[model samples]
Target: MTSLNPRLGLFRDQHVVRLAAILALLLIFFAIVKPKNFFGLATWQSMAIQFPEFGLMALGVMLAMVIGGIDLSVVGIANMTAIGSALLMLQIAPVGSDASTGYLALAAAIGLSLVIGALAGALNGILVAKVRIPAILVTLGTFELFTGIAVIVSGGKPTSGLPPQYAEVMASRLFGVIPMPLIIFIIGAVLVGLLMYKSAFGTKLYMLGSNETAAQFSGLKTTSLIIRTYMISGVLASLAGLVMLANYNSAKADYGSTYTLLAVLIVVLGGVNPNGGSGRLSGVILAVVVLQVLSSLLNTFPNISNFYRPLIWGGVLLLVIVVNQWGKNNNLARLFRWKGNAS
Candidate 1:
């Protein structure tokens, strides 16, 4: 019963409540402005299919943010993994292929990409943990290095010529409605949520983020833990790359360049502290839904230039940061408590 209360308290958390309210308001506003498009199956499908890539990236961001770190190299890691997978697929099946050969190639590509992702993560982890450099600096440097390698490997062109089975496996709808990418995203979310809440590692991570000095004094293996956390982020980023590869039928150096900002924004808006002591995967998942819906809404207006999106996202991020700081200064928790009492 006591445990249940603590869990219930999360539902009553100010951030969760606020996100729910904003999501509802956004839906209502869009529905009112574009009734037909907002309420359509196509819109919903687009939202479901598209958000997962960003969602996956944001989830990786959330992990780093949880540990009081950031991974700006996610975009580079994702592109590199996708390119590697493409190269593997081509090598496996060559020019023309049978279904059996293509499936073999797909399996090999997935395995290879995951390994590459882990290795990429290990590199970031070592620089940050072993070398004791600040995470932001380490990741930023690696981001450029990874991107340069990807560009050199692919010669600045998208890798296309994939086995037909690659697209077939990724594009097929699960249960005739849900996109496979969405399903993959949900699975990742669930695993991460459990990792953050139900695991001892989660507790240690929170402690480390809250106060690194204290964590080290308490005899926690801070370095290894940071390494493992970044490794997880890398794997998730690679998964995003694989999904993007399938979605577009190609892999490019510049793919999802805007994603890095959007991902950090998602993590921040999802209520992860920049100083990084507290956060929840549940909140991050809701944030994903909200952003996806908002993104799809932007697409509904044909006259709205796609270029406006980053600007809008940037503006929203700035607002959220300001509001977040204000809320902290103003004791917004007390305000919520007061409002709850009045209600």
Candidate 2:
């Protein structure tokens, strides 16, 4: 009992530890309830392939939240960048092109798409940081603007018939055991971790999020930091776009339309403070897996409709927020103390 107390205290204080335990419990529950569906390699592989799209977007959302801002335009940026990439692919390597030419075109399209994402993000930064508009209002307006641009560019239709090379490389596994999307997600997470944990930029970002006035008085370039943060987010969103284009073998204006809400939910569920200045990348990553597992668990129930997913997600988000509020007030710890005494 004495030994267990330390672990219990650790779990109480560490968001990542709590998230990991919840993830484990969820996986075990699913396995028990639907062994045929959840105990197989196919289920896990499918989750690995599918979650990276929105998981990357969630990371972008996490960055924005960390800096005391929000980016509602991530889905819009992702879809728009994908649409642009698809259009570029059609022009550079039409059907009947050789595989080498298709690969070259794919590379060029990815670069250009990232550039577009950066520019779009920069625009949001300027509106929020320089124009003195609220972050929520700026991103809300740009969300519609970017989505509108995507619709116009794609002519309100799915852009398809691109070279097979894009999907082949993106959807293909490296060794027939691991997934390509999973690999890309790992790389992206690593880069973000380094940027946030190992650099001066990350220090400045936390400072700014904690108190913008203090940061400004301390001689930090608040505007530039905010702009760069959003730029990184845009790049991440664009990367997700490339992955989406590969996964679906096409692009559209409305792909992953529900992801904006999902991203915010994931960030908050990961124990990120919505008001900003405190979060862990590990917690966010774990939350992504936990949500994916939950989603998969839902799919195992044939009677459950897909439309209820958003409802479930919203409920879970609200519960997390309520719990976090309790934690902030130390009420959650008091409840734990009461339980411990009763035990």
Candidate 3:
């Protein structure tokens, strides 16, 4: 274990460096390929607006992965939350309503969405921690459960006709430059960083992930920890749903269906081990940026259909997993050699 620590530390640093390099290279490539399109503020702004939709989901997924679990229900939670919020907004302030009424409706919708997200997340936690169902199975079940509820509530139709102020405020830029979604993403990431790095809860989470048995024996409230972790994930998903609602000016049960896959890809690409107990939020943030850049670069070619995006994403995901696994093996070999030399 002692010998492995230094190797893991070095790998973590190298992973960040690799992601940074990839981002820089993608930027240069895009700039050269479509200087007129890529060099413009509009292009960058569009990227900023789009990435946060899945980027926030990736953050939630990262938290689950860090605790040695996976939350497949993030996209479902997001859709359900958005659908509920949209319905509430329509009820409170239909189109052509007063601005004051619209604002009030917006606040109420946000509050309700968050509360719904929390309850949904709590249900997953209860099933996993209390009932001892595997996290993956529990989340998978809830994904369908939540999606079904969203469909029933929405009647398989998009929830539209939200107050204009909702989009005007949410989609608006600060000082005519920075996007609201980008700002929200930054704030969310920073808060997650603080929670993961600056608090006792973070330490306990890591310890639990590293060795649940040890955590249990040491008197850590493992059940509570798991529940809290999933709750945070749920909140993140709800937040992402709100962002999507603003962007699309509507909500639907099947919106961003591919986002669950993309979120997992981002988390894994960010260096969070699927096996658990190790990863960095910083790496996850960089991974989100890297993916957004790659996605923008792909847009440079009109011939590449958006339908192929899943194929591309899946290929990259497999490649990253293989590379990460190979690196681990190589590091273990070196550690063994060092032990042999010392003996």
Candidate 4:
């Protein structure tokens, strides 16, 4: 009889295995609690609608985390972009009866938002990488600064008067049943997945995260990579903001305030190391879906009390972190160690 390879017996990476287990458990929980709602097209559609915007933000957070940095400024970028897009769209639309002008204005708004996002991200990169500042402190400061700017610009008012065509495009189905935002989410996930997993830059990022000094000695342009990562994060967050603005048919200065923590939660919960160096975009995508499902299930319980949502979210986040650490450090490793000693 051939001897089995111990590594082959289990998934090569225990984190991946744990993530799969969590996914399975979530499915089972939903199946038991809300059998009909768990697998319905409507439920899926609802989740699809809500996930894309946050999913985009989470993708950015994943990239930053993979690079051993954090982008707390993302929520700020998102809010700024959202309000900027709304304001630009309003300005560009013709006053009386020019549909073509409205379309032109919408295009301008999107382009402007993308540019602003890139600039904002670049600024963050410069601060953290070139200025030699700690990412957490820099981003926290900018988080407040950017949000304050957004508030000043919006004056605490909800944006409205978007073109009808814009609203329709945002709300309309791509094919027959698929929501456009959901499709955007899928595309973003795939692209980010490829960028993070299959590209040279991705390798550099992982290397940098694993050891910055070693990466620098190895000839990696660490500073440039850091800048690029934040830029990408900023652009993604802005794109998500646009999707959100369209979906809600409004924009506010605080549109993405609650998302900073949520993004961190998703990235860590998706099996990305909070300390950086190892993570998968696919895992993040699955985590987003799982979270959306959990949120939907909670929503179905009318008397469950809305105030508990954050508490539950926090609890789940804490559980994921503890379980992830235990899986990596204690349970799985100890099992392998015991098997090795016995052998």
Candidate 5:
């Protein structure tokens, strides 16, 4: 019994650990419920392909949320970048271009799209930081603004007909099975992890979110940090846009509209404190996998419609919030004389 307690303690020590156990149980449950479907390679492949798009967006959301902010503009920024990239590629290589020319156009389009994303993010940063507006309000307005710009640019239609190269390379797997977007997401995760774990900026971000007043009094440049943080979110959203554009071969002003709320749900489920100043990139990544797998597993059942997924996501978010609220102070821990007593 004592040995079992120590092993159980390992699972209870961290939110990620607990979530991982839940994920493991969920996989096992799905496997038991539908042994044939759950074990199929196609199901796993589809889940892997879908994970990165939402995962990347959720990471952006996590960053903003960590600093006690929310970015409603991520969807808009993603669509706008996608629209811009498609339009640029069309002008550069057109539909009938040779493969080499198409690849060149693709390269140029990627660079231009990233720049557009950065500029858009910079606009978001300026509005939130220098303009002295709340992050929520600023991003909310930019959300519509960017989305509108995408629509106007695309004439309220999908931007398509990119160089053939774009589709070919995007579809091509790294080792003939792993999707390119998954690789991109891995690279992105490494970069984001370094940004958060190895820099003074990350420290300042946490401090600012923990207590802006104290950060200001400590001579930290709070406004600049806020701007930088939003910029990262904007850029990440743009990367997500690229992924969508590549996958669909078309960019629509309203593409992945579901992602906005879904990203929030992922961040919340990843154990990011909505109030701010605490979150783990690793947790968000794990959350992405769990949610994606759950989605795929649920998808195996014909009775569950796509419409209900959002409802389930919202319910999970509410449940987590309620659980956290109930146990946050952990009065019961003190009553039971737990080892780690609250200071």
Candidate 6:
């Protein structure tokens, strides 16, 4: 058994290997196609800037997925939170105001956004856990509900008149080249990774996902963990929304509508089991980086129309699904054969 353990470890860890392979492939492809652009610090910085919000959204989705659930409402929540921040900023610091006042207004806007996000998440959690509705149905309902509120509040118009400081903070370089958004993303990933991987609550989440009945039988608080997972997702989505507002210097009701599919793609591409119970943050981080690099590559190639991006993304998703199924089947076959031999 000990002799076979190392071989089993290799198979168990194949997801990690695949993630690294994808990243390496992306780097090689970018280097070949856009040598000059791909190697520049400016290009790297731009890629870093593009990641934070999408990464955060992906993180939220990953957490829900790990708990054997999904949150289709994250994009809607982000959009609504972004609009809420914009509206609050406008109310507190009209068209013109002193920089200090603008800063305070921004702070207030963030607080309001967080509160709104938490409420939305809580509602979704209650519907799923207490009301005994499937997460898919609950989140899908809120997706539309939140987006509707966002459109009504923004009047289908882009928000402007943001204070200059917002842009300065978003675009600022720390230590000469690190963008503020990238720094925020790193911090978020580290903190959330620790919470999900190192804490007792995280273990409970995995146990619930693996088998809710067993977790409950073992005296785990499954319902509370599920609710808390969604709540955390909501908070992270709201934070992403704020970053988007600051980075773009404008907000729109539909700002995050396109991110819904992207977030799911990242989670799946990261090798997270769709049926849940097993995954890692490292794979997710690599997947996000790979996708961002792919986006950058596509952006550099002017001839590759933006309309085709979705098609490419869809194809990649299909491939990932196929690969996951194949891996699972192979593992199951091996496990059964081993059991038969032991018998």
Candidate 3: tens digits of C-alpha lDDT, residues 141-193:
99999999999999999999999989888899999999999998998898888
Error of 4 at 208 (Å): 0.6
Worst 10 residues of 3 by lDDT: 1-10
- Across 154-259, the per-residue lDDT of candidate 4 in tens digits comes to 9988888787667677677877789988887788787886786568888888888888999999999999999999999999988898888888888887775567
The deviation in Å at residue 51 for candidate 1 is 0.7
Q: Write the per-residue lDDT of candidate 5 for residues 205-299, one digit (tens) a residue.
A: 77777888999999998888888888888888888999999888899999888888889988888777887877777678888888888888878
In model 1, pairs of residues that clash are none
Q: How does candidate 6 fare on TM-score?
A: 0.91
Worst 10 residues of 4 by lDDT: 1-10
TM-score for each predicted model, relative to the true structure: 0.93, 0.92, 0.93, 0.89, 0.91, 0.91
Measured by C-alpha RMSD in angstroms, how accurate is candidate 5? 5.7
Looking at model 4, residue 188 earns an lDDT score of 79
* TM-score of decoy 3: 0.93
What is the Å distance of residue 261 in model 2 from its true position?
0.8
Weakest 10 consecutive residues, lDDT, candidate 5?
1-10
lDDT of 2 by residue, 79-167 (tens): 99999999999999999999999999889898999999999999999998999898899999999999999999999999999888888
Which residue pairs come into collision in candidate 6?
none
Per-residue alpha-carbon lDDT of candidate 1 for residues 192-303, written as tens digits (9 for 90 to 100): 8788778888888888888899999999999999999999999999999999998999999999999999999998898888776687777788888998888888888899
lDDT of 1: 0.87
Stretches of candidate 1 exceeding 4 Å from the true structure: 1-8, 331-343
Model 2 segments beyond 4 Å from truth?
Answer: 1-12, 331-343
Cα lDDT tens digits for candidate 6, 1-343:
1111122354356666887887899899899988999889889989888888889989988888887889889888988998988888888887778888788887888788888888888888888888989999999999999889988989989988887666766568898789888888898898887886568877777777777889999998787888888888898888888888878888887885668888888998887777768777777888899889989988998898988877888888898887677566487578778999999
lDDT of each: 0.87, 0.88, 0.88, 0.81, 0.82, 0.82
lDDT of 4: 0.81
lDDT of 5: 0.82
Least well predicted 10-residue stretch by lDDT in candidate 1: 1-10
